[model samples]
Target: MKNYWSRWMFVPALIFLFSSCGPSAHIEKDKSVDFSRYKTFAWVDKDGEGRKDRNNRNDITESNIRTAVNKQLQKAGFEETKRRPDILLSYDLLVERSTVQNNDPVYSQPFTRAFYSPYYRRYFFVNYPSQFIGYDRSERSIKEGTVTISMIDARSGKTVWQGWATDEVSSRNLTSKEIDAVVRSIFKKADLAKR
Candidate 1:
């Protein structure tokens, strides 16, 4: 009983912690474009020249991002073709320094006190009121990463679908897990239908 109660008590805190760590994803696409027609995709640059313009480019990070994106696209029933794909895929990643403000609530820890229960003829544990002291305000600099993926119409040379994801990163380069998360988040918002 005690373990069950304690487990349930931390549910809200666990939820908040996880919810705050997820990346923010957004997508934009041509409303008139038919996503179902895009059956094959080829990278705009098979080499790494596409990312040469980015100052924070890391070869390993780029590879991880591409692999993750490839997995998601293939899962969506899109094939990778080099000859001439229906859509051209391109991706860009940027990690910039940013400041985050923290305003955490301060509260006194609750204590349990024994109280006499005349009706029950026994003693029971009563929780004392925990007062909110105030909020601790602080600021810290952190690295934020934004990954954008664009799918363009090969013949028209116009972007048909684009999605981006932003999240707090530990450093200038993203870990494998983080790259996967970013790609998964962006693809989750993509309007790809399985063929």
Candidate 2:
């Protein structure tokens, strides 16, 4: 009886293993920048709501987003500033708590198929245990993400260039490494555009 069940679970397991196979990201681009003479920058946290916690409007600012932005920008050869800069930069983080469902319809197919051979029926019946029960579940967690600078004209304060990227990072807290990875990727796009 136990052996009969394992056969049923083989396909679903295989289906799940193959289905979850890529990165989670979506980026939007703006291509109206006068890329020349826009190397200097000055920025600040403009969104008060971004710095405030959703619950109390006071518990936000876990990581200094501005500093992280500076790190990435400087690494790209843009100079920092105090007064008016050719570009003004600002950034904000967005955390969303949600559930991700796990589903693998073909996960159990292979195991079941192996057991069904003409000469192996009895062998499978004797050795295999209960099948994996189909219980589609969800992982509940948070998605913390960042939105970087939307370049503005220093003379007119009008946004001209912008790039964005997001990754589903682990939810303990935002790490500098994680932020750097995503930001660096977006900066690469800017560099590519320069060429």
Candidate 3:
């Protein structure tokens, strides 16, 4: 009974351990652009005219994202400006839901026991077991969220760099610190300094 309980406990621990490792970021950039030439950036919607159309995000959420991005960019030596900036910065948030079905094989067998005959001194099997077969299915719904940041050349008006991070969404909303961590992971893969 103890061994069965231990095995049952171990399965969930393994799933939790793997799931908590977090998600990876994906980044892409235009190789032809000269990143060193750009030192300043301005928000794509500097005038706030396109905010309603492009980003339907709430004010608080948008503010948090912008603050996080600003900190990360400033750390990378890029300054924010209102006029004649070298590059334009913009971001988008997305949430998607999907169903995941897991078909696990459930096995069952009849209990067996060996009994010894005193006269013959031989053991005989009772209640022989049967072949194993799958009998159960499980299904779950999962939500995934993603944040994408883009950098465009002010003069050419073309996207020069893009980075995105995706992770499984939880029931509770993400904290500011968690959002910052996700942005940091995306930029780590971007490696803008190398450009």
| Candidate number of the best lDDT | 1
Tens digits of per-residue lDDT, candidate 2, 13-116, equal 88988545322334443455556667788875445553355532122333445556677677777888887788886554554565566775423332232345
> TM-scores of all models?
0.74, 0.58, 0.69
Candidate 1 has a TM-score of: 0.74
70-116 per-residue lDDT for model 3 (tens digits):
88888888999998999999988876777778888776777889999
In candidate 3, stretches whose alpha carbon ends up further than 4 angstroms from where it belongs are 1-20, 46-55, 103-112, 115-137, 171-178
Candidate 2 at 24: error in angstroms? Answer: 5.9
Clashes of 2: 18
TM-score of 2: 0.58
Which parts of model 1 have CA positions greater than 4 angstroms off? 1-21, 46-56, 107-130
Give the local distance difference test score of model 3: 0.82
Query: Per-residue lDDT of 54-141 in model 1, one digit per residue for the tens?
Result: 5657668768988998999999999999988999988888899999999999999989999898999999998898999999999999
Give the deviation of candidate 2 from the true structure as CA RMSD: 11.4
Higher-lDDT candidate of 1 and 3: 1
Question: How does model 1 fare in lDDT?
Answer: 0.86
